[model samples]
Target chain A: MISEEEVKHIAKLARLGLTDKEVGKFQKELSSILDYFEKLKKIDVSDVEPSSRSFAAENVLRRDEIKEEQSKRNRKLLELAPETKDGYLKVKPIIKFS
Target chain B: MEIKELTIKQAHDGLKKKEFSAAELCKSYLDRISKKNREIFSFLEISEDLAMNQAKEVDEMISSKKEMPLLAGIPCGIKDNMLVEGLKCTAASKILKNYTAPYDATVTKKLKAQNALILGKTNLDEFAMGASTEHSAFGPTKNPNDLSRVPGGSSGGSAAAVAADLSIFALGSDTGGSIRQPSSFCGTVGLKPTYGAVSPYGLIAFASSLDQIGPITKTVEDCKMVFDAIKGKDELDSTSVELSKIAQAKYDLRNVRIGVPKEYFVKGIDPEVEKIIKSAIKKYEDNGVKIEEVSLPHTEYALPCYYIIAPSEASANLARYDGIKYGMSNAGSPASKLLDVYLSTREEGFGPEVRRRIMLGTYALSSGYYDAYYLKAQKVRTRVIDDFNKVFKKVDALFTPVSPILPFKIGEKIEDPLSMYLVDIYTVSVNLAGLPALSMPCGKAGKLPVGLQIIGKRFEEDKILEIGKLYEHF
Candidate 1:
């Protein structure tokens, strides 16, 4: 079973603030789930190469020319932001002045 | 004629013949949505005005004596995860509760270009994560067949919408059986096209590598029509591929070979569902089609492997909802740091199942555990792929039951996430291997429907659809 600290660490990495009840619940759930995933350890994958994609995908390239329609789309996207000023999305301060 | 029971072909023919106007057909569906949507919860938002205006355009075209596309007058549902350009695309999550799509998804664009009337956006599990729509932040979509049971999901709303005749058809994305499993429960025809067969541009990303958008319809023929309209390469999506370059072999029933994977028929499957699937295979054999028992030994590991890989990708995809750009944000308070904004927004915004998956994925991809979990699952994924590769060489298509059980009760397995994940055991391997598969109603396990899954090789949608068509007639 995974420890509660590990679950806490994972939540921190995922940037999620969990209530104490949720932390306890996830601790039990994630432990059981990880135990189920332990079965994969028995398989012999020494000779096999890991594959992330189901099919081969070649890189697709295109010209980087900007279009008038894209700027219109940008304006629409900016409108969705909760806080915007001068056509820029506003967010909480990133730097701390201690 | 009962407008509710009209298939795509019937609707198209009726429109061309002027038996009824597109506006009339559109209103009939809107009327049905008004009457039934409250109980089933199939649609999250109804685009009544947009649908009416599109119907008017089709009516105008008919009057002008212009040729019409097959989907020209068809009113359909877009799964809420795909963007529809100005429509609400919530992905059935609180995070995107007020989020309106600013662009059209490639499939939506394709459907719009064909003049297919958009009825509204259907519901799904938050970020298409759960096997049932119970994870939907709004509410669960009840099965039309049995009000107490769940319509399988995260494509539950799309399947239920089609099954309840709320929409002529609907589009759904499959990542680990999201489309086919729900179609099985709702008794609608659904296809999960080969990876890259349809463009994923504008689809709310789930597991990027495993994600595929396909159709849910009343019949295989309608599924084919929708697939044809939305499929093919797009410049916006790099993974999208043109299927025309690959030559398809015409299948003859008498000479075709069908394999029943032995692993899928084992314990845990409801006996009635098994019996129905076996009988469906018997009908194929009765038709002079060769039936053989095949073994895909890696089948048992598919669900576990999928749990790892899908979550790993989902973690990365979901990281974008950090309260800065569009979506529900919790950053308005004084002295709120950027990190605190991410934490509080996500904590308040995402549903439980979505949070569980994101956490699971984050842990799996994190340092020290990455090679043990994610890498190992990917290698097993290769074995799953190889199993399909070896079996397809011996058979034209493989047949299995879409799910082990019937449409389960709404709250039965929601608390037990593992059991919910187990629901996709028989369907996830196809996604892992990037193969085309379809779920068609084979027979009934009592009043509940059983679906026969027909899986084909990569880019072999034509072959499987033909096989499904053959069984559909029988």
Candidate 2:
């Protein structure tokens, strides 16, 4: 079973601010879920390789030259930012800059 | 004849023969949605302007001598997760409630190119998390089959829209049985095409590996038509697979080999649902097709494996919703409240189920636990795929129940997440294996509907369509 401290750590990692009640709820529920997942330990999966995707695919690349159409799309995407300046996304810094 | 109830093929033919104009077709659905949507809560928003304008274009194409494109003028309800430019693509969460898509999704672009009339964006479980639409911040979408019951979710709104005749057909994304279970409850035909079969270019990532978009229609034929119209490799989604140029052998019931996994009819299944599904299997036997027992031995582990993997990927995928991007941002000071922006924004934006998943995912993918949880699930996932590959070698298709139970009441499983998660037991394996599966109404148990699931091998959608069409009564 996972502890409340672990749940708090996970909440921080996930960038979620949880109330004391919600954290308590998650501590109980997540532990039960984790306990349920304990069943996987019985399976001997040593020889098996993990499957990340359903089907095989290769990275697709196109000519590296810039196209006018792409610039138009970039402008549109920039508009989705909560704050932007000079066609660039603007966000507060994690560290102080001199 | 009810214009709102016409299948895609019927509507396509009717529009060609001038029996009704595209505007009339659009108006019929719009009119129905306006009248019935209040009670069902199927639609999050109705794009009347987009529908009318697109309908008028189709009408003009008809008025002139030009031939209508395939699926043109047939109104469809889109799950809100798909980006439809200028329409609010909320995925039924407050985070994106006010966020309008800047550009069209690949599927939306294709549908528009064909002149398909889109009714509006429909509700879903927030971020497509839960088995029932009750998880929606917008509120639950009631099953049209029984008003007191739920339209199985997270695609509940899409299924309900089709079942209630609010829209003729709809698009739904399935990540852990979102499309199929709801289709079962609502008595609509839903197909989760092979993973990578349909492009996921603009589908909001719930669990990227498990996610797929497919049709929820009134008939298997309509499902096939919608699938044909929307499927093709897109340059944007590298995971998307191209339809093979080599023609696949046409499948017919007389020569088909279907496998019935004994594991599907396990205990905990509603007895009435089991009886009805047995009858569906019997119909296939009554036909000339070959049926035999096949074992997907790892089936028992699929649900637990999915719970780990899906949330793990979702935790990573949904991290993009941090404030300072185009979504509902928590208003605060930039420097001190910067961390608060992400925390407060997500806290306010996400619902309980979404939070539960994110927390579970964060824990699973966290350091020290990744190998035990996420990595272990992936290995099990590989075995799940291997199981299907082995079964398909013996059978052309596999038949199973979409959900173990019938359309459950709205509040019945709401508080119990485990019970709600179990409703998808039979369907999650298909996603885990990346195979094509279709759910169609087999028979009724009491007043509720039962769904017969037809699963096919990787990218063999043609086979499932043939099998599903045989069972589609509507």
User: Of the candidates shown, which would achieve the greatest lDDT relative to the real structure?
Assistant: 1
Best by TM-score: 1
DockQ of each: 0.83, 0.74
Question: Candidate 1 docking: what grade?
Answer: high
DockQ of predicted candidate 2: 0.74
Q: Which regions of candidate 2 deviate over 4 angstroms?
A: B250-252, B331-337
lDDT, candidate 1, A1-98, per-residue tens:
77889988999999998999998999999988999998887788878988899977788999999999999999998988889999988876677789
Relative to the true structure, candidate 2 has a C-alpha RMSD (angstroms) of 1.6
iRMSD, per candidate, in listed order: 0.9, 1.4
Inter-residue clash pairs, candidate 2: none
What TM-scores result for chain A when each predicted structure is judged separately against the true chain A?
A: 0.92, 0.87
Candidate 1 on B341-372: residue-level lDDT in tens? 99999999999999999999999999999999
* lDDT, candidate 1, at A27: 91
